[model samples]
Target: MARCEFCGVEADFPFICSYCRRPYCVGHRLPEAHECPNIIFARPPDHVRKIFEGRLEEPARHVRPVLTSELKQLLLAWLVLGFCFSVNSLTAPQLFITTLLISLGTLGLGFIGHELAHRYVAR
Candidate 1:
């Protein structure tokens, strides 16, 4: 049988404080009731806490899109193309403007092909 950490009572169905991971009886189940130490550390510093203390509560929102979002994936695709082009140009400096254009076109097509493959696999 588990015992409550605060009142030392035998608990049949103890509630655990998530932060400190301690068991408590129904009466002391809440963090406040057990005077949980985590509550103090979880709070922001006094100076920063005061600034937003009176702000109106707003519904939670996503701050930013995921790194793998479409926009980021597209940007990464272009970046890889540019890097490959730069490395090829440096290695073979004799390539003419026509060759550069062909390389760019090929990379663009390759990027499109990759996207199509990804979509096909997803379906």
Candidate 2:
């Protein structure tokens, strides 16, 4: 089990950066405003600029600079698309099997993409 670096808590499901290989707990994870991989991949483009601007406007806390630009854009794009599909499914015609497949596929893709993102990003 990996212990959280910031909180010193034991974690079986530690969220680690695939690029940097740094382990962190959910609590210790980067804020949505920072430019971490989670921010780059998980955040919508609309919010990233606001995050960037906030950091500049506030001098109370230090913000880490983006260290690397290497990323799996395709995987991130696919995962984002899957999320959209799941959301849009609310209005989709209720085809039982189709809905089930879409839901399952979305979950599977999300899990796989998360791991792959870590693998590609972590050194």
Candidate 3:
């Protein structure tokens, strides 16, 4: 077992400081805790800004109007999916229509939102 240099405690699993190259216990594992002389090396590098520079620079896209065919297809899909999903809940005739409508609206919106998010992220 390695020993902590600062506290003189024996450690089964010791933490080695990247800056000072010294073994330390959990209590004094960090550079600050062990009072490392080369403390500047412990600081993380700020490379995110440099790495992602100009990556998000994209031209604005023109908003295209939805076609009537696309609207019909979406509605048809939503209706079919809603009926299939709500088939199990058909025991109560009163709640059958409500469940179907709710399923249709939620599934349609959820699918649209998911696609939008994917496009935005993949851009």
Best by TM-score: 3
Worst 10 residues of 1 by lDDT: 42-51
**Higher-lDDT candidate of 1 and 3:** 3
Cα RMSD of all models vs. native, in order, equals 10.0, 19.0, 9.5
lDDT of 2 at 62: 75
How much is 68 displaced in model 3, in angstroms?
A: 26
The regions of model 2 sitting more than 4 angstroms off are 31-123
TM-score, cand. 1: 0.35
Alpha-carbon local distance difference test for all models: 0.75, 0.61, 0.82
Model 1 per-residue lDDT tens digits across residues 20-112? 899999998888889998977655766433335777555567676566577577767766675667565665766644455566577867887
Ranking under lDDT, best-scoring first?
3, 1, 2
Residue range 1-123, candidate 2, lDDT tens digits? 998765778889987755445677877666342235544565455633335745654335675555534335545666566555566556665654476467558775776778678877985
**What root-mean-square deviation over C-alphas does model 3 reach?**
9.5
Give the winner by lDDT. Answer: 3
**Which portions of model 3 miss their true places by more than 4 Å?**
44-108, 112-123
Error of 2 at 70 (Å): 31
Alpha carbon deviation, residue 106, candidate 2 (Å): 34
Sort by TM-score, top down from the best: 3, 1, 2
lDDT of 1 at 90: 64
